[model samples]
Target chain A: MSPSLSWIDPGELKETLSRIGISVDGPPAPPPSFRPEPSEDQPSPPPTPNTEASPPPPHFEPVISVAERIDRFARWLEQLTHGAPMSIADPEGLLIEGRGLPEPLALASVALDRALRPIRGLLGTHQVGSVTLEIDGGRLVQTIWVVTPIGRVALGIMVERPLEPGRVELVREGLRRVFDW
Target chain B: MFGLTIASQKGGVGKTTVALNLSYAMARRGWRTLLVDTDPAGAIGLSLTKKLSQAPGLADHLYQHTPIAGLIVETKLKGLGILPTGKIPADESERFTNGLADGAVLKAIQTAAQGRYDVVVYDTPSGFVGATLGAMRASRYVVSPVQAEPIAARGVMRIFEVIGALRAKGHPVELLGILLTMLHTKTQSSLAVAEDLWKTLPGNLLFEATVPRDPAFLEASAAGVPVGLLRRRPPPIAMVFDQLAAELEARLAPDAKDVANEPIALVD
Candidate 1:
């Protein structure tokens, strides 16, 4: 609905689906927290410079980092969500996969809506392919994911499978840590 | 040699079938071929040789920095070599993608394959996840197989978007072609869908022969042998495979130049 000739934003759909208690299995566990101060095991990275005064590197490094992160997250999703296959509709139409997995996925789309609304004014969203999902007894139990310019994000839940509450808590916390939510 | 990564954003698209037959075809043509299975499902290993419970494949080589060629295990199939990912591809994969700054396995294999392999086929995992990207980065030419369906065509387009993004970022990887499989010609819908994709997909239109869906691929899957090796009935599918093999061979010869050499053309 947002745009013609494009794929749907799976993250938004996932949030909406989570609302009705659908869980998904594919999306990455959010990234390890980016601490302002270095963790004990690792030495501190080079100190941040004053943005106004510091010149950006001649070659862009942050862009490369994001691409690498997508790869990292994609790997996580692929490993856990081995069974189901997801696909993006033409262009950016709603992401679809494993038919009949709607109820819980619809709810996860709701949850995704809640999460992205706050960030919408700041970061634009991306359209990724169908989240891997299974239609198990008409309830969803897993998370799906998509890769974006900023990083890899979770696709909405498939109603066929609901997220396990414990794992949801863990991923929720991880999302909080990743975005400082 | 253009290192080719065969990937699918969706599974059950005959990715392994393409990989297996492609390997057999290469070997039959007297090319030194290596099929690398980055798929955790281990379909390549399962199809090519005995199921491996424990062994050093890509994950081991990537995580432990094992010498790439050292992991090569020659198969019963004469002109082929397999570098497999046994049981722990996932566990070991996390240790690398989550931890390493650079591609460990890609670097290892590419360096070892400078002259050793005339063709390297990477059987990618299903989906647009990390494994597929890693496989794509390792190979400059990507060969994708899509089920000849509307939904499947969408997957093919999405993957091209991915390939396009990578190339835009100077990844230098190029899509070789989008090959259609499971040709259900009886269905008008499927045929129409294929017709539509020819107009949508990018790059050189491959030899026009489509790989017809046949029970031989399944039987070979059951027997853990390449379809090209199966001597069976309805010889048509086998003949299709022969044509498919020749088209790929012509396209993938080490001397094969960049796709840019010819103006990029869509199927339309």
Candidate 2:
């Protein structure tokens, strides 16, 4: 006697495999003639033929990068400093982001960072919080450095009017928040 | 006395370094800590005091019946004491191993340290046999130091098996946690291994504090002292041990309130 063939549902097979921690691709889409009945309250939208030309759906949440965060912070600091020159650098004194800062001041910030980098050990050891330098035009180049999990980050601002100690602390706190230090 | 044995299956996984610095950190925290070297290689003695390397230590006490009290070496830290692996002669190495294989020598050491030290940290050699097994058999807790490398991470299971077997044998030894050491964040493989361990291991199985790969450890080893005492101001890496010690205290006594949480009077 010949045995009758039995077919296993692809969806059931996929679910069983997934339950056992084995991932397999879902079954191919059903044939066009097998469309499901739309619910009365929420009907499916009409299919659009030009799907490839349409823009992708917007994401409700967007992921932000550290470099982008630093850039945003630098721009905000620039507005606070009244368009004064400013820059932010990594632990290695490499510029991550900058705003309206002159070449001389940027070089000076990097130089200061390199000079003080050796003395600074780990995150909590002998931390050099901030440094201020007087330039030729009676302007103060104030630099605040913070050690983040990523590494040390410095924010330098050149302005004729120096920010108060509290304001400088606010800047430091802002940098810390940006890096989640 | 609280007994902690630093055990690992792989060599150079920072077991000795963790044991040495952890004991120092505990001593600094006002715990009368005694560091006992169970390794026949005399790593603890060589790392701390050169003079004590040749001196009679735990091995001598086990083999020749030397007094444990007399062999305890006082360190610069007032709260810390050292019992080095003294003079494991090549001829009597087998005897020493046999002595450690049995738990009587460890019981004697514990008895001697009962009232003297608040905590006794044992620095065992690599592998879960002989001296290491003896130390674990005598210890109330075991903390495994796993280097942040693929092979070292894989060896962690052997520690679990050893601890499990000891418990099955009715030993009161509990696995404290696996400490990831010598982690280089810049190295892709190192970071990957550390991340994998953190994600894969149970929340309570791994320590929150990690030891970074630093040259200061070598400097401290050369100077024959704990990394915390390497310079006038302790290196930043030294503070990692302080964090580890704090975590250990928290794990060992979860219900106990931290002294730091207590507020002090400004006038006083």
Candidate 3:
């Protein structure tokens, strides 16, 4: 409930519903995701900038070349987990390099791009920073981005089954070390 | 010419029936009309004509380079045309899912219809997903046929929410009106719900003409003809659709000439 609307009485609720032509005897329906602005007496809420509206332009034009970086990362990921298909894409979702990815995963990347905006929006709104998708029942795909000093890089890995807690930590640590974050 | 999409988020609300009959009514009134079926289920072909059920259509035009003009079939009713949703292959569905955008397809269909038809009516799929959004983007007007039941009325309200969201994003589409279908006056609950919606919903959004629950519609559909075009002297529900057509024409009459002159290029 919004702080300002906390003062609303039952009579006002009926009156409001009446003005909207909803002649309901019960209380009016609650609003979805309403957040009232802070009053003068209250301290203002922390500013949450809409980074999506004005994302910083990509900073890195890698001198090492994209193909070289992709090859290096693919080799490193192979050492971390054997026989697991993986694909690496930039923050813009263009596939940089991939190895052993199934046809469905390769083809579903476009639909997956549509999900990225909503995932970013959810991250912006909430504290959740990482997202995972379960594909083909048991197959799991976890994605996390590394914000380096130069630019953002998104890495995704697909494994045969759901990752154990220790394996998830290992994956995160591997990404952190691989990106030198 | 005005491009209208008869859409609803809920199924079995007579969207195909409305699209077919309305096209016939407009054609009978000396307007060249085209009905485009975008539903993958191909209900329009089942209801209107079965011969073209497996015919290649919109998907073919989008996936392949098949011209939209070649896909159009002349219906039994004079002055009316249909572009059926014919045989989309598995790979084509994969392409659509993999971002074969509808912008080009919408442009092709509308550009073809512009020179030949006075109105293009799109009968969309049930949910407000990819095909519905594509149709809405191409259309200037959206007229939703809402079933005269509580749950279906909620779906009608949901359509308004989607229309508002589209307009907020600067899309030029607008809601024409909500047509109440399958009304049974003898039932108190139906009459009460209709009366409630009539009084509560905002100005001029509900159509004055209501389609009664009649077996004539099913009979006409089973016989593969619009209720308005049946061989009988006058089908029982034909007058209801005629009145609806007259009202719609009157509403669209003021800008009809202006719209005919200014068809926009279908690109983002």
Candidate 4:
């Protein structure tokens, strides 16, 4: 989905200047010069309000909106945990793949079913923030840690291999949210 | 299946070197060895390779509710596998031993490694008693490497205290062997220290081999190469390790012959 951003109006410049205690009667024009004064630096040029947009004062990265962060984290968690039965879905709905079925497929199907139950509650409150690629033998195993108000919550990952660094970051953000780290 | 944890109450006495060389020595001789780096700092993993950059190390598995296998890594070398420590925070000791013994972390490491490796060698954290005890419980034998110095020998007594504490609690751990590391050929202090230890400690727990104080030991460690594989004109350290591995095998599983006779079936 294309994210819609609110457009800023230049007219709001007046209000912004007032915030810094600058009188909005735009700086007074320099006295009219017949053929602008050309002496060696004889006349003061009109104080050109530094028009260049000063980059916003560096601040702690603004708190990420809760929903947006969650979405990003979910994508990473899903990618890393692609085929594990205990699959976590976006912030709300989920399907936990049960351990393989008893008769091979039968028991696994059941494990997949029960695993999804905790995800909805997890999604509602947390964002996946970090992914730990655990190695089991030569293959990959994933555990997604989430950040929340109380503490870090770990979501069992079902992925069989490791994810690239870029993808791991998004999941880390989500987990940081779920775990409150 | 029994396990051995080679650790030190102190650092730089060839803990990682011993652990890595012993691991490589065993692996090269064909005993499947699984090395577990439980130091949240991951020095053991660092000595083995340069690939890993973060945690989910053995310690991470304990706090996070998940399968421990997620942290195990198969090294580039043959026969030696590793379970690396995860993003080790500077305060892992504070967190790991907030209340419980550091061994709590190792219990999970042991559980995770069961049935997977014939020999699980844990390179534990230095200083605190908790990490040592944690390694002790999960390990069948606790081997310490002491440099031939007054202080390193004193450290041995300190380790014995920690082991004695564990024994009082009913842990079946044994002081497998004490390796007098970093031997200097001309120094009387080193020779005296080794002699004193032999006289004081029981004969069964001491290995006949002594690792030499050589520049190659540090260079190999810096290059991430084991002494056993050093292509340069290696000092006696490599041979000492070869002997150390054999002594350890005979000490731990005496019924088994040299590493040549054993074929360890690896996990994966």
Give all candidate RMSDs, comma-separated: 18.6, 21.8, 18.2, 25.5
* Consecutive 10-residue window with the lowest summed lDDT within model 3 chain B: B91-100
Candidate 1 wrong stretches, greater than 4 Å: A1-181, B52-54, B89-104, B199-203, B232-235, B252-268
| Clashes by residue pair, model 3 | B1-B260
Candidate 2, residue B15: how far the Cα is off, in Å: 0.8
C-alpha positional error of residue A162 in candidate 2 after TM-score superposition, expressed in Å: 72
* Candidate maximizing TM-score: 2
CAPRI class assigned to model 1 = incorrect
**lDDT (Cα, 0-100) at A140 in candidate 2:** 83
Worst 10 residues of 1 chain B by lDDT: B94-103
Instruction: Return the TM-score for each candidate structure.
Output: 0.57, 0.59, 0.57, 0.54
lDDT of 3 by residue, B114-162 (tens): 8688888888765565677778777888898876654465434457666
| Residue B11 alpha-carbon offset, candidate 3, angstroms | 0.8
Question: What DockQ does model 2 achieve?
Answer: 0.01
Candidate 4: docking tier: incorrect
- Which of the two, 1 or 2, has more DockQ? 1
Model 2, runs deviating above 4 Å: A1-181, B254-261, B266-268
Please give the range of 10 consecutive residues that has the lowest summed lDDT in model 4 chain A. Answer: A95-104
Residue-wise C-alpha lDDT for candidate 1, range B185-210, written one tens digit per residue: 76655665566554333225333556
Candidate 1, backbone clash total? 58
Q: Per-residue lDDT of B26-142 in model 4, one digit per residue for the tens?
A: 877776778877554466656645565354665566567556667677766776777776664433444553322545656655666666666778876554345556777877787
DockQ for every prediction shown: 0.02, 0.01, 0.02, 0.01
* Residue B211 shift from truth in candidate 1, angstroms: 2.5
